[model samples]
Target: MLHLRVIAPAELRNPILNVLQREPGVTHIVLHPNAAVEPAGDEITADIAREAANDVVERLKSLDVQNLGAITLEVLDTVLSSAAYHAEDAADGDAADAVVWDELVARTRDESQLNVTFLLFLCIACLLAAVGVLTDSPVTVVGAMVVGPEFGPLAALAVALVRRRMSLARRASAALLIGFPVAMAVTAGATLGFEALGWVELTSTRELHGVDFIFQVGPFSFVVALLAGAAGMLSLVSAKSAALVGVFISVTTVPAAGFAVVAATMGDWDIAAQSVAQLAVNLVGITIAGVLVLAVYRRLQTAKESGGRRSAGV
Candidate 1:
């Protein structure tokens, strides 16, 4: 369920009331006429069934409530009403499966910010992966994967592509194009700095078989990335954020890219080339999977809507 608070002008209060009155899933309606001092309008509040929220929100938006006044919606944790139950039954689709495109675009736009904190986290994550590769530590590599912020931009790109938002797509692309190079460069610099400080030594060598985890690229790597990409986007869109950590752990982008930079710096071109290939494979797999999964979900949703229309004799 969702609690919606709308502030609209007095002139349109009647139309707004009509929308609420017409929606069977909307209840606990409260009207405060000319109650807003700053906005100088009526304040209306209602509890809308979660399943029916999308339709109700769309109707309200069609009236330009967002632009003229304001519309605030928040999730309702608890609703104890038979009316709410019937309202849920009255809804055309399940809210849990709902994809609010506007909400998604806003979320991705925010996540695509290429700020100093983003770079800082990226560098730290890359450095951790570099160290993990050098020491052949899967745990360290996993830690780097957890810290890396690259998934946000990747997911943003996927969302933009699905929504046909070119500006958002460019923002996500810039983040990735600028982020990876910067992070990889810092990883190399960190290696040099560590060597200078007598922290560890790395030399061009052929005995890097132990770190095969970083350099080994195969079809399975792509398959895992594809699954992780779908899971990551689903977790984000469905508000199941806890599942995101698992997605992070499942992808190889950070570790492979980090290893590529460090290996190249140490003159290990064979290992560097392999790591780069692994990185490329994982990134492409994730992207293609994300877009396809989102598209499929949308198609299924459309089919469900069509079925509902038929059921309603529409």
Candidate 2:
């Protein structure tokens, strides 16, 4: 299903070719010898000739070819048999690489930066939720839920815990810890500013009791968080990323945090405490669920690998 292109030194070419040939999903191997000048002895290139791109990548990693010079295995969806022979041909690079775990981590780290877009998105979401709470509009609340960008780092945290990558875990945790506080502070400032401009009257609403929606944690709150976390993780690993937006909408984190800020601004300490409790409950529940789901996914992958090895008598 995959097309492998190997450009190695005259001596190492045979060994590398033998490895590729033995790989289960790899076929249509093309060898390029005496290709170019380089510091390393050999240059290896591969493309995904099979639909089992993940399997092929894992097999390549098992060969431990990093010490070799500039080994590039570009996983291609379409077969380019003749193109492998044409070393100088230009092609679109995006289609050449498959989505691997490390690449996913790198992409997530890049996307989760505390940039202006992230701040704006969180701020706007919280503001909308505050307005929703004031007007008692469930539609606006759902809008706020969809606008929150809290899932990026949470998903990253889950992946880190599954892989036992402590650095990633710490980074993700720091992002969450800092991001929430920052979002809340901004929301509070905005609330105060609105009050000064006479744009928001906190006392005029009869539905101050409706603020209980933001606070008032219960077993169902934890259940929702747990399910959201599992769905978020699944959305990350599966190709169904569109479903993640819906997952974001289904949770109340942004709305709760925003409501808590509004409660604090109105000098409602009791509601503020309740909102904080709600936030804590959701966060803990999601983290626990995400970790559990990732652990199971990793276990299943490991079991599959072990079974394959046993079948091959390795």
Candidate 3:
């Protein structure tokens, strides 16, 4: 179940209340008239079934409630009401299957931005992966994967394409373009510094071949990328952070970028080229897969809403 807190304009308060009252699986409606000091309106609260949440939010958005007021949603850990039980049972679909695009849009918008924290994590992840490659440590590579922030912009790109938001697409692209190259450049300098300090011994890369295969372009690479991308999109929309971490571990973008950086700085052009190709394959593969997954999910949502509207008419 989800709980909503709405602060609505004075004129829209009654209409908003009516909308909540009329919606199924929405219960425990409360209103405090003339309570909003800043907005000078009313404060309202409602409990909505998780399955009905997307619809309720959409309805409120259509009424322009978000434009004139604020709507906040919180997951309910415990609901004591018998009405809540029946409402949960009465919901039409599984809660986990709901996409809630508006919520997704808000989330990705914040994540896709080119911010200081984003660049910091990207650069750090790159350096860590570079260390992993130089030392041939799979553990270090996995740690770097978990640290990399590239997935946000990647997922943002997918969401932008699905939503056809050119501005967001450009922003996400800009983040990737700026973030990846900058990260590689920084790691390259770090690699040169490590070489001068005699901290790393550049080897044949054969010892790490089992793990280094991730830094090669192949059918297996594309297949893993596709699976990771799809799972990533699901994890993002569902707010499943653990699943997202798993997605990070399964992709090769960060590792390939770092490997390419170290190899190029060390004048190993063949390995550098191969790793760069691997990076490209992973990025493009995952992006295309993410776009497809989001598109399909969005279409299913549209269909479900359409079906609901038709059922209402009938």
In terms of TM-score, the best-performing candidate is 3
For candidate 2, write residues 37-89 as lDDT tens digits. Answer: 76434445555432345554555555554444444544344454664433213
Question: Candidate 3 residues 129-245, lDDT tens each?
Answer: 988887778899999999998888888899889889888899999999999999999898888888789887765554565467656778898899899999999998777889999
Summarize candidate 1's per-residue lDDT along 158-252 as a digit string, tens digits.
Answer: 98899899999899889888999999998988888988998778875356565567678888999999999999988877889899999999888
Ranking by TM-score: 3, 1, 2
| TM-score, per-candidate, Cα-based | 0.90, 0.78, 0.93
Candidate 2 positional error at 10, Å = 8.5
| Model 2 misplacement above 4 A | 1-16, 27-55, 62-100, 204-206, 209-211
Overall lDDT per candidate, in order of appearance: 0.85, 0.68, 0.85
RMSD (CA, Å), each prediction: 2.2, 6.2, 1.9
